[model samples]
Target: MGGRRRHARPASADDLLSQLGRLTARVREEIEVQRARVELAEALQRGMLPSTLPTAPGLRVAARYAPARSGLDIGGDWYDGFRLSDGTLAFSVGDVQGHDVEAAAYMGQVRIVLRAVAAMGAADPGEILRTTNDLLVATDNPLFATCLFLRFDPRTWTVRTSRAGHTGAVWARADGMCGVIEHAEEEIGLPLAVMAGEAYPVTEYRFTQPGALALLTDGVVEGPRFPLEEGLAAVARVLRDGVAEEPETLADRVMEVAECTGHSDDAAVLVLSHDGPEACQTAGAAPGIV
Candidate 1:
């Protein structure tokens, strides 16, 4: 018993090799699967966004979209320039919860249906919400969405807007005053896809000629280190920073400011500046530049 002998089974080299080979194959397949999932996810997110923004006569619209840190967090941020059959221009900005394919797909569906509802000459933000809600109530997993809908009738430079669960809008007049239109008393209305029968009332806010209104998601107003108020002040400060005039330049300035300030969330901003007949000839001025 002093020296015990250990019994051992003969090793099977070929069997071990086969096992290693199978493991490698399995890993390769898994990688491929992951790659495909990413590709599909990107496609879905891209699909949710507009392939090309629509053009509406007598209206100048500019938008900037930023996906969350990863492309996958793309979520449901979207901007639509709706052209009604009656010659009205409708614009909306919305955010859905997920960046997955389903969110992207539903985002597309919501935009189409909502645009139709808003185009019915019912320029009510609340009405658009209600009608869109009716259609989505049928969806079992109906996703949730927050939107700010604005409609402008070239007949009048005045624009009417309604907000859902989204952030309130800031209108900085040509005279240099900044006012936040609290989401209508109706701003508290539930988002679409939740309660189908819920009644949403539209609170109307009018912009005088030569006024500018900004419609945006929380991502814009809730940037790093700043609550809604700070983010908004930043926006106004940047807008009045003495430099951007072209519609595109204004949009770019806001986006860059948000990004530079460490706004990690997907930031999207849609700014509409209405220049009365006087400023129309040269809309390219930069008190709004970055």
Candidate 2:
């Protein structure tokens, strides 16, 4: 009989099964890594926001923000409001150095650290900014940003304003008129992190009575091919309607226009009004929006 080439009992079924198991484990590990990456990114995104806005006496704040459609635009834009230890209502809006998960995380750190510095630096808006600038310059990332800090006394309707490289805000009165709030004559720039210990200036404005103030980030008005000046003009037009009786309503209306017709970027709108009790009552009714 011809010697049949010895064939090992086709590699044992057990060995074959082991090989398949190894392949399956590799795929599962890859998937796990992918999932972990996404979860980490999302958690980091959530960390970008302030835990809660401070509620000071006679104050009502309504703020809304939506990031890019695909969600990752955390770009260092942050808004913070609180009652300082000195009993003044403090608010700030800022945009940081970059746009990314890392940027957002850093933005949160900046927000908290700066808040501590601002709260401790006293209610002087300019001093708060000057200190923040020094801290930013000294930080490891050396990240820069543009910010506007305002301290307003509801009892008097007097607002102390400080601008450090940011788009200006607008104040709308009860008389159906509006205009950009301007600071004293001074160069408007030099991002915070660029110059350590540089002095920033502050200006003040008083609304004869409680009215509405609309503050925005560049993203609120500028996107893609949209001309910034034109977008800002559009914002001015909305404010022209002058919805002081219902700031939150006005906030929603303006946001609707942007989401429906304006540029696509991380957009935020805040309407702070001294419109008083009646306004707050109707504010909840500022038209329904999902």
The lDDT per prediction is 0.67, 0.67
Model 1 lDDT per residue over 72-136, tens place: 34566777775677666788888887766667677788888897777666666667888888788
255 Cα displacement, candidate 1 (Å): 1.0
Candidate 1 lDDT trough over 10 residues, lowest sum: 281-290
Q: Each candidate: RMSD to true structure? A: 5.9, 8.1
**Residue-by-residue lDDT tens digits, candidate 2, 171-275:** 665566666776555735456778877887777765553456777777776766556666666676676675455666767765665654455456666667665
Q: Give the C-alpha miss distance for residue 133 in model 1, angstroms.
A: 1.0
- Candidate 1's C-alpha runs over 4 A off are 1-36, 51-58, 184-186, 242-244, 277-290
Give the residue spans of candidate 2 off by over 4 A.
1-42, 56-58, 70-73, 184-187, 260-264, 276-290
For model 2 the local lDDT of residue 152 reads 71
Cα deviation in Å at residue 270, candidate 2?
A: 2.4
Model 2 residue 91 CA deviation in Å = 0.6
* TM-scores for the candidates: 0.78, 0.75
